[model samples]
Target: MNTYHIDAYKDDIYTCVRSRCGFCFHACPVFLSKGFETYTSRGKCMIMKAFLEGKLPASQGLADRFALCTTCGYCTSVCDVDRPEIFNAFREDLRDAGYTIHRHDEIKETVEKQHSPYGSPDESLASRFAWKIDHGSPLLYYAGCTARYRERAIAEAMMMVLPSFDFLEEAMCCGSVLYRTGYRDDAMRQARALVSRIERYSTVVTTCAGCYKTLTRDYPVMGLQIRPEVLHSTQYLVREYKEGRLALSPVGKGTKVTYHDPCHLGRGTGEYDAPRILLEAMGYEVIEMEHAREMALCCGAGGGLKSINDTMATRIGSMRMDEAKRTGASLLVTACPFCVRNLRDAGGSELDVVDITELIAQSARHEK
Candidate 1:
């Protein structure tokens, strides 16, 4: 039993560190991958205690383990107290150690080189679909680096159904890559620049849960009060439908689907309803995994894990997708591009993983 972490975790970050925050065990894909007692939240707390007490110095493997965490906030959500800010505090620890992965390094390098995360976002990418940067609207549609690169279809879905908002697709990083990898200064610098660019917008929308949380919660702490608004597609869509802005018909008339909450969207930002609502509204028979909503498992691609631990990350994703499969659903719907990409790679057609927007678009009769 280790105790004493650091000044950042000096307080009872958890209401009761003694109790196992089994949320991770219940919903975390990483624990499923390792299955070691040490991989669970109890293990994480012990490890942090060792660091605080100087019993364990942060070694390379230890650092790797730390980096492996998806920072999904599942542990914190289940904790009665402290609520898991330790993960955020760990970013400072990584910065001190000067440890980073290629994903973070590549994106930060690109951001420093290019104005945005994507070094060379061709107009063709956006033009390939109907979505445009400026559609005479107040919202800024951030496609994020992942969607801009591989998951281009998700962007196309955004163009078709949610066409009413203004769009700003960045080939640039969201400072999330840097933030998660322990480059706080670089992350803040990028966040400031982004805040400057989008300050005038009435709202900011994103397809990436990572980007959504980064802009909504982290940026504000850095004095980037992004006033317009930050919303994931699911949330915005639900709002739109309620406001009469979106007319969601029963698109998934007969499809059976299950939803996997992105770590950032579900736990980071406390969003769990809009997506389920969207599925239910669309006539898709939505199924629930044992670990649903805040207790949702991570796809293991987050916290730069996909960058540093590809094999393990894929394994973790497979574990989660396996759970979706158990629900007996035809499709597994996720709101984050990272989750969608990783889950697809792991599933390899064993299951169908789709972005919420694309799922809707497939069955949707566009209003416009």
Candidate 2:
């Protein structure tokens, strides 16, 4: 059945192993945090090579090492070779070999039962969409799990800025968590369900970067396709502002703001300009952090790492927050709900972290 999709990357994996290039070393969040070669992309590739060559057997220890990665695709952005695809395939192989993390399993089970990875009490899909408004516009807002559950403020902000859009009352987990955690079958199942629900819309707008990337990038990779055009809220807002459909009251001059590029939005989907464009349009002085855009540091909540190793995830997020603090910006803004949650959790009261939509909504209220 060619389950792992590893055969196609066999040659590339060999080339990477032979080159022994360290280009992706500093790019990995886990490796940068732990200072271990085994946590880097190159290190993960080496382990996969050994497994493919039958030099090592699958073990819990090996699985644990693989689980450390956030899979933020920073290495893929920098690597001369395609490392993300190979790494994803390696994860599939690990799962197929019956090696899976317990937290990931629990998440998958929760998703299967409750249509959410949060493992919260069962709630009707309608309850999640209680805030939904059907403006009868072709655009539909798919507020992914984190935004709908953990961070309702992001969704509320989106509702404030968007003129008229339908909410995906049938929306479930976008399976981003499952896909990154190596539950391919479960992820595909969720993807199929989401695709079916969104087929009626002409365009799908996502407030969550993970949902945006999953719908636009990961679903197609899994051979599941949605007919509607998908846009991140920032992308949609930028387009609206550019087209003169959306207006924003300018922030006070010299209001310094810095942006964090969520890995899924930046490295995963090649969207580095939209959020910045929106911020600049709002008359805020946008400062660049040391790692912004393509080289942006992960917020450390991705790839089920937050679920598996929260302490490590928070440590990485705190480091990124430190970088933001160094920018001397009064506010840190990002496009992803997951990034907002993780960065806020790590930054605490030291830094103000907000989603772009929240800022936009605030600007709109100021115009009143």
Candidate 3:
């Protein structure tokens, strides 16, 4: 029996455990999938409480249970009082206990040697948009780890859209993988190096929602200030709209698409509008999955989960694919390459998953 008590780190989450049980369970994908108290937000909260109070034995099971948590914070969104950052703290608790999974080790190895989780940043450094670079260009494009290896089409699409961006001369490692896993020292060190390389740029744009969020939102803590007018691709698309530069044809009668909200891009950073707006501009008759926007479900591959616990990430991603399939969409579109890759991996047997960039670039026109 897992005896549950409140831990000091979990104290931030204490307010949501109300006895009235008002939490809307049907809204949570994790709860729907697991159908248990231990996996539900309330259930996990109770478990953390018991562990903190010394009511439950700290064991291997504890690691699995905590690892099962997606840290999505849907529960906190519904709570009368919110403590959305608790899962991060709880993850730290697990790590402090020497309970990290194997991917953590692999990622650390990549960061230590290659400065990226993908293990190679060289081939990925090439940009189709390099021709746009001029002396003292104000814009730098940041291609995240997955984009460097698996999703070049997205970068290619943005290159087609934004004409004045420069790729980083230095590999462009943002160190988000370190920050998420509580490797504060490495994250800071790696982040400083990235910041120093970009000191010349007045703005930076990224195709990766994770890199955009981490650089713009978290890098300031180290006094590196990754805050150079950062724009996620969609935000740049909306800017294109304002500039009257992006052109689109209608959905052409048969094409239907749905959007998958990347957690960091949507809920974490409040960026649901730009991606959807871009899709709308492209004339996609956008249908939505059950969860969308700030309340949207994660595609289940962010926060280094795909590296650490791939089976769980795949399972969750498969479930997300099923939800997208439910919409009868001909194609599923997303912004994050990680989300695109994970969801495509999920639906490769049965559905089509692609980056919004790839979908758009297929028909995007170049100025004559």
**Using lDDT as the measure, which candidate wins?**
2
TM per candidate? 0.88, 0.94, 0.86
| Total backbone collisions for each predicted model | 8, 0, 4
Instruction: Kindly list the per-residue Cα lDDT of model 2 for residues 29-100, writing each as its tens digit.
Output: 898789989888888878878877778887888878888888899888887555665666677777778887
Candidate 3 TM-score versus the reference:
0.86
How close to the true structure is residue 329 of candidate 2, measured as C-alpha lDDT? Answer: 96
Per-residue lDDT of model 1, residues 1-368, tens digit only: 43222465655533335655455466555677777766666676777766777787766566666666777777667664333346545545644666545466786787788755556766566555543446667877777878766688887777777665565544557788777666678888888777777778888778888899999887876567877877887887888777766776777888899999898898888888888888998898988987788777788888778876789888888888888999999999999888998999889499989899897776554444
Q: Which 10-residue window of candidate 1 scores lowest in summed lDDT? A: 1-10
Query: lDDT of each model, Cα atoms only?
Result: 0.74, 0.83, 0.70
What does the lDDT read for residue 291 in candidate 1? 78
Clashing pairs in 1: 5-52, 13-82, 15-81, 116-172, 117-172, 117-173, 118-171, 118-172
In model 3, residue pairs whose N, Cα or C atoms come closer than 3 Å (at least 3 residues apart or on different chains), thus clashing, are 4-50, 5-49, 5-50, 6-49
Candidate 3 lDDT, 133-181, residue by residue in tens: 5546788777777786677778777766665667765455688877766
Query: Which scores higher on TM-score, 2 or 3?
Result: 2
